[model samples]
Target: MRRHRRAKIVATVGPASNTPEMLKRLFLAGVDTFRLNFSHGTHEDHAKVHAAIRALEAEMGRPIGILQDLQGPKIRVGTIRDGKITVAAGESIRFVLSGADGDKTAIPLPHPEIFAAVMPGHNLLIDDGRVRVAVTGLGDDYIDAKVVIGGTISNRKGVNLPDTVLELSPLTAKDRVDLAFGLELGVDWVAMSFVQKPADLLEARGLIGDRAGLMSKIEKPAALDRIDDIIRLSDSVMVARGDLGVEIPHEEVPGRQKELVRACRLAVKPVIVATQMLDSMVNAPTPTRAEASDVATAIYDGADAVMLSAESASGAFPVEAVEMMDRIIRSTEQHKLYRSIIDASDPGEEQTAPHAVAAAAADLAEVIHASTIVAYTSSGTTAARIARRRPAVPILAITPHAAVSRRLSLLWGAHSVLSADIHTYEEMVERALGFAKEEGFAKPNDQMVVVAGIPFAKAGTTNNLRVVQVEG
Candidate 1:
């Protein structure tokens, strides 16, 4: 069965809602995707969750996407010697970086790369910006910063440096191991955190090697700077607004989110708007009015998905959050503007063979007022190309591989059908059209546009297109 809504809900898995029974309830509540955060859980723990989800999939007889999120290069303060440091506002407190067992300073600077790259006048936010520090001077072994705004600093508080780029690789050692585990586990998607360049995506994709699609999280300022390149390199993109908001001006995040979503759509890659969506529902049963509007905006902005963080993972209301998200997705999609945005992507020029074939299929569907558009894709690429056009009719993507079927579950307007291998382009189209007709998804008189590739065309390469009428 195909999902009716477009804005898919991605619920995070956490300690509060990790049981198999709870996961099943979440699936029933309309969660299209499950986000397994690699930062918190052990590999064994994730393995258990993976098993449980697969069991649910077997029972329900439907595909559910699993996204593995890697913790990429997280910078935090070292241990505080006194365990706590209370500084009043306007009080000048010194932040010292020393190898002295972290016992002398109010907050020990653990990341030496941050100190080396930091210059005077740069601002450092600690504990989620509750405390602010301004670099005043650079020392031989340590960097000194004066507390411009001080608050009580605790152990291992989060540090945010907006101005300076730390000389660090996007993937940490832990991320590499986690990615390997995800590949072995056969997850549907892998989300790389703090991706700053296309090279980061290339490295991850090389490791993944088509086992799972790479999703770049736009959370760093450097990432925002190179978003076009990142979008081109990655299979999908996510607007990770949490750390992104901290890194950039708060007022600019909303615009950035829209821009990023549009860019991904033009590139024909699915984009997810994530972080703090339905966050207030973590404790409260009902979301704030503003939060509801935020979700609607994401849908209106043409995002393929909207994600939930603590709302479904550790919140008091996990199932309720999913249900609410489902309702909002359906409701927002009813708007006339929603379809406009979906159809607003940059259409490919009918020049290249693949582009010409994809465009012709879309055009034929529109000309014949077809009820269904069937695109036979081996790698789910040609189907995605057609989906980027956002034709008004439904897209039926037939593939032989089960992995490709599951991955297409996250793409917009694509209903994937797993079928036996067809040797020729005509056989692929006939199989797809026959399936659509046999399932009563389309009537006898319904028309459809069929797309495949020429002789010996590899998967993901489409060089043929045809318009066919379903025989009675």
Candidate 2:
């Protein structure tokens, strides 16, 4: 089934929507990608879900994307003597690097990396900034800080150091195991979290290679300074506004989100605006008006996709959330100002032969009012290049590799299908026309623009273009 809209929906699969029947319903409701969060589930839990998705994909005859989201290094407080302890504002608290239970006088923070990197003026956000403290003194094993905000500090609550960059890899011991397991399962995308700098992507890349698209999650404030480099190194990017929202000032989240989305578009890579898009839908069947606007805002900003976290993962109404997000995307794309905004935000143009060809194809399709623009891709590059132009016509991305087709599920304006590689130019035209009519992108008399590489089954050879008629 072809989706009427161009922007795709990514929904996290969790306890609320993991059943085979429910998964089918969610897919039919318009979920392009399913994120398997490794942070909360066991290996066994994820494998079953992965198998279910593959089975559904085979049954539905669509390439569905599976994203394995790794939980990076999490710095948390040690156990508390009582279940929780409350600290007052302006109170001096010493955080000792010990695993022992903590008391009011000294809070035990077991992570040495935090102690090593934190400076005297750095702010430490605990339990999601409910308890805020600024470092006033430091030692080899202790950090003395004045609590800026007073709240209860519970055992093992997460710690966020916004000002300090820890000398730690994004992949922890648990993440390594999870990565191997997800790779073995043949995941389509691996979303690495806690990415501080561009170098954070290198280690994950070494392990991932070309198996799956490596998507770096922008959750740290430091990543904002070198976003262009990070986008270049990454296969895709995700504006994970959860931890990101907590680490930076709340007022700056919106600007950062827009900045990250624009940077990804400039780099010609897919970007997903994630976290709290439909939060109220977690318990209700419908989303709040503000949440609806949030999803629309991302679409207006030309983000490739918008995501659902707890709304679809553990929410009471999972399918409803997906349908709401689907409706919002379709409505926003149909807005009168939507195209103008996207056209104005177009990253000028890339200076390359392939990009030139793609741009020419896009302009030709708009000029001739073609029904569809077909791109014969092997690595999905040809389709991505063309889709980046945001052509008025729908894109039919024909690829032989199932992996490539699945990954294209995240790109903007791409409706991908799997087919055998075509060797002859004439054969390519014949197959494209047949697909256009069969996929409902065109009628018998409608014209379609075809863009394909000269060397068949090769990547980065997107130079050929043709205008062809669909035969009955």
Candidate 3:
């Protein structure tokens, strides 16, 4: 069942949502992407979810994008004595960051990388910002923190010391193992969490190579600090709102979300707005007015996707949340100014050549009232770029790789098809038009626009643009 909505819905799969029935319902509810959060599920469990989604896709005859989210290096304070402790402001509480063996007065920090990088007076937020502390001293194996804005500290609470630039790789050993599994399982996109710099994305790409597309989850404040570089390195980006809302001041989230989405658009890269979009719907069948508006805002901001975390993963109304999100997206998109904003975005020089060309094709297609925009891509960059434009017409992206096809299925306004490799531009155009016809996206004599790169422009070089009409 093809959904009429343009903004994609990403439903995170968990115990409540792993069933085939639930997966099908969510798909029918307009979930364009499924995110497998490695933070919660085991490989065996994820395998089952993966199988269920694939089966559902075949049964429905529609493509569903699968994203494997690697639980990046999560820094947390070690266990507290009695499993809980409370510290008052200006108290002399110390986070004895030696190892995971401290009591309530102090907690061990297991991440040596954090210990080495932390400097005195830096802010340290624990348990998703429940407790705030300032670093006071550092030792070879231990760093001490003074309670600055003390609050209740519980067992195994997440710690976010953003001021400290830890000398650590984004991928942990578990993440590396998960990356291999995700590749073998044929996941469309690998979402690397808490990505701080371009090197983090490059490393992930090195691991996945061309096996799947790399999507950087921009949640960390450090990532926002280096947004341009990270966007340049990543194939796509997700604005993970959970930790972002926790780490940064709540008032800043709205502006930040808009900025990130606009940045992604100007760069012609696909971007998703994620996390707790419909938190109230985790229990209620319908979302609160605020939640509905939140989802609508993301769509209005030109996000390629809006994601449901706990709402679709472990909520009482998993499928209903997806359905509600879909309804809101479709309704808001009716009078939405998405096409105008997308059309107005000037593809900057900062973007890659292929990205710029794809944007140009989308712009021209919108102006010409083309039936469809056909993209022949190897790395799928051109296809993703066109999708980012969010033109009124559908984007048919034909690629030589199944991985690329699966990944592009998640983007806004894009439908991916796997085709045999084309060695030349003529072969590329013929294959694209043929697939478009077979898919019933275009008819004979229908006009369309095509974007590609010049010879030797590399796999993702999409500097060439051509407009043609299909012939009988």
lDDT of 3 by residue, 146-227 (tens): 7877788887788887677677788999999999998999998899888877777777887888777788888888889999
TM per prediction:
0.92, 0.99, 0.89
Residue 451's lDDT within candidate 3 is 77
Instruction: Report the candidate with higher lDDT, 2 versus 3.
Output: 2
Q: Which parts of model 3 have CA positions greater than 4 angstroms off?
A: 99-104, 138-144, 344-360, 421-440, 443-446, 452-458, 461-472
Candidate 1: 10-residue stretch with minimal lDDT? 98-107
* Pairs of residues at least 3 apart in sequence or in different chains that clash in candidate 1: none
lDDT of 3: 0.81
Give the winner by lDDT. 2
* lDDT, residue 294, candidate 2: 96
Angstrom error at residue 168, model 2: 0.9
Give per-candidate clash totals: 0, 0, 0
RMSD of each predicted structure: 2.4, 0.9, 3.0
Runs in model 1 with CA error above 4 Å? 88-91, 100-106, 344-351, 438-440
Clashing pairs in 3: none
RMSD of 2: 0.9
As a whole number from 0 to 100, the lDDT of residue 139 in candidate 3 is: 79
Give me the overall lDDT of model 2.
0.93
